[model samples]
Target: MTDRFSQASGTSAVGGVERRSTRSWSGVAWPTLGVGAILALVPLWLGDSRVMMGIAVLGLAFAAYTIAFNLIFGSTGQLFLCVGALAGIGGYGGAILADVVGLPIVVSIALSTSAAALAGGLLSWVAVRRSLGVIFTGIVTLIFALTFENLLLGLGELTGGESGFLMEAGRGTFLRSQIPPYYLMLGMVLLTLFVYGSLRRSRFGWAFRALRDDEVAAELAGIDVARYRIFAATIGAAILGLAGALLAFTEGRVSPTTFGFAEVDVVVLVMLAFGGIGSFLGPILGALTFTVIDELLVEVGQLRVFIYGALVIALFLWLPRGVVPALDDLLRRRRAGS
Candidate 1:
């Protein structure tokens, strides 16, 4: 009896060690290091300051927005279509607060983000109460977006209407300069990545995943399904608001045209789809790839959108799991063979 017990214990200990070693080797840290190294080398290879800076700023903004989308679509299994509209609300709100209310840019941003988050939370509450599916959610958000655009157009005095608000004294400083914006965006991206990483390791993340897999089962397992869903939406919206604020500051202006349905739909869907939607890196990969492609094809003018649409459709048809998952699978297979 003693010998049998000792043998079992010994096997368990050895298995545990092996498992830990394997996980340590195939960890996020190594992947993160590789990504960082690549980013650091980008400036050295890309001599065009304007292009590089534009890419960095746009990438960072889109990354934030995509991450926010992941919190709802990827994590909570909720499909939200108003992400762009919420961001526009944040942007316009910040601009108004700064320009009209005489608030500082930073304070205006904070206030604007908070307002958007609150609105998002309210929307989430409505969705959760009704148990709205993806289709309904999309419809609701689309209506909200159209309403916002029309409101902006009708209220020309406050929003500067169709002409848009121009930043006079606010423009041309280092705060508005390319390098400063790039560095600021980089810092924000790092912060967002850390926040998302930590969240995924938390109890909330587990609950969210469970809810995503089977909401009824998760509820039976003691998870508050509605609560988790609402929390996800609220958190996602807050991140979106922050991204919007950053974009507004970067552009030195806020305009209704910026939050149009077409742009919003293409960006949000492309980012989530191109990214694997399985891991934190998925959205990052999607955002970076989309931005690079868009920049490269911008010279093609009107043909660019058609090309992008075709590429996206092709990707969906050929690689449904997306670029990241396919590449990761290939890498894993190669490693296994080696």
Candidate 2:
């Protein structure tokens, strides 16, 4: 009777936590969708300027990247430093499959996405097997990123070297059009948000939080830490792959610069940091804010990277928890006072 009662109580407690998580996510879901709706209307103002529209598309891409990073790092504590490399794998892989192999773009995207997921899963498996902590995982992934960049530079004949590979695959299609590409990327952003939110409301979210809060405790509580972390990494990597593949198609080229670590990974980390690491709307907010900042600093030229480096240090030092969570705390304080 005692064992049965204890088991029943534990089940109820777990159920209560899930219910609370669902409610918490539900409160934020509509606002997230509203933000997406607002972004969808951006073509209304910038439709005439191709340059602005291009910047907007790039912003959405970065937003998607941050979201993927958030899922891997924030949810499960896997610090993957090769965000750009995994993305480059998809971008370069898709372009090669379409242009060189003469496969349909859709087929190429699927294959490249699958390849990225497998690669991500393998990386996660290796990390788990080695019992690597966050810093070690980042170090290993950073090495992978460096190797990928060198590979692009070395394989001049195949990858077009630093000149970039012109994607004849998406040429003359709607992807080349100015407006359609914006909506296409917007769709991806919204889809990614939905997926993230859904995971946060499901059993996966519970497991993620458990492991994130304390891996040893989670393990004691019967949570499979390795499996959940790898699953999160795989899912996040698939999103990154899909986003990268689409970016290649829309941009009509793939270059080392396009998916370089300094370009994609650093910028994404800054965005994720500024917006809030674990907050639902944090990545979008950070991406949007930094995208505009980046465009504004375009005239500064070479100095822009220096400025970003400074911002990364400052933001991490002062706003470690990020703007979204900070603001959320302030709001709660005000409500309590009222």
Best by TM-score: 2
Cα lDDT, all candidates = 0.72, 0.84
Q: 296, model 1: CA deviation in Å?
A: 1.1
Model 2, runs deviating above 4 Å: 1-29, 335-338
lDDT digits (tens) for residues 1-338 of candidate 1: 11111111111211111113322323444545566667655656663687677677778788888878877777777777887788887888888888788888889889989988887888888988997876787788778878888898899988888877875425767757756677676667666765665566567767866676667789999999889878888888888887887778887877787766677657777776777563567777888888888888889999987887887797667765566666766776788799
Models, CA RMSD each: 8.2, 6.4
Kindly list the per-residue Cα lDDT of model 2 for residues 1-338, writing each as its tens digit. Answer: 11111111111211122434465565446756798789989999999999899889989989999999988887888888988999898999999999999999999999998888888888999999999988899999999999999999999998999987898997899999999999999989988988887787688877887777668888999999999989999998999898999999999999999899999999999998887776667788899999999989999999998998898888777767676656656776788799
Error of 1 at 262 (Å): 1.3
What does the lDDT read for residue 237 in candidate 2? 91
Residue 324, candidate 1: C-alpha displacement in angstroms: 0.8
Worst 10 residues of 2 by lDDT: 1-10
